[model samples]
Target: MGDRKDVRPGVGAPAAEPGRVAYDHHWARDLHSSIRCSAAFLALLFAIDWGTGDLTWWRSALWLTLALLLFLVLCPPRVCAGEGWMASRALLRSRRVRTDLLVSVRTLDGVAQLLVLRDAVGGRVEIDPRVLVNNPDLWYRLDEDARKSAASGCLRSGTDTLRHFSERLERETALTVFRISGLDS
Candidate 1:
């Protein structure tokens, strides 16, 4: 993790050896939010039971279990990308795909938007597009590999999708810069 290099221009992220993996910069903050939410939920449950004089050992145990489940549900996977690969890791497992061998990229639209990438070797990973938009370093790694995939003729789908996504990222980046410079008004 410490060896990861970031190539995003104008950002103050530390540079390291090339070819090292890049990770989601916002992962820690999101993880902390998940923890806080689950803890607050547990506290509320306990407070309600105690206030009603219904708290018991068994019930406490149940509440704790519920809180743990809530945390698991709320937790977000950590996303990382290297020269030719991208991965998503959750509490229990990790999914990796060879970005340089990608065959398809699809955007699933529902309650939450998801970007699904499939590789020539049957590797697949579903990730949130916001992760890329928010972390330019990770996006850079993926974009570079996707280009390789395209050049090698392994990528058969989502060229237009990737182009549109790149445009969107550029727009968002510009907007953020404007906001940071107080020129967004």
Candidate 2:
């Protein structure tokens, strides 16, 4: 659907409580590796540029500016799923799609992989798959909504894509569970 409404799912979600899964108030997913790598790389550069000498204040300011800029540019989304829909809030905007009315689910591969969801009502959201992998509650909400959609004939297609996404998430979840149980092979 080409038409969409700027709507949020806060009121309709059960109890309007905080999300039980995939709720990242900060950068959405794990940024530890990225942050560490960036910081370490910057440190190395600073050290190389000013070895055994007092570093210039402007240079320190430059490093701080670089790190802050990197963080702001790479900031992730604020994703939450409600009773019937899911939303991914980015820096200045958010995207919400009705799961129960989902028309299709597909992935676009490029520099990054995005799982795209579309509804008959023209609502759409493109999110990172890791978002679902990290938050089971969001998956549950989407799965439940998709199930209801299928039953209602609102969602007549995209079963394959939906199943693929679901399976990937399930496999990851199982793997995490096994690892936690010390059952990794």
Best candidate according to TM-score: 1
Q: Where does the lowest 10-residue lDDT sum fall in candidate 1?
A: 1-10
Which clashing pairs does model 1 show? none
Supply every candidate's count of residue pairs whose N, Cα or C atoms clash at under 3 angstroms. 0, 1
Q: State the lDDT of candidate 1 residue by residue for 1-185, as single tens digits.
A: 47756666788777656688799999999999999999999999999999999999999999999999999998999999998899999999999999999999989999999999999999999999999999999989988999999999999999998999999999999999999999998
lDDT of 2 by residue, 11-102 (tens): 54344444444454434234655567678767876896689686788888888788767765666777888877888887768899988788
> What lDDT does candidate 1 reach at residue 48?
100
Give residue 43's lDDT in candidate 2 (0 to 100). 85
lDDT, candidate 1, at 185: 89
Cα lDDT of all candidates, in order? 0.94, 0.78
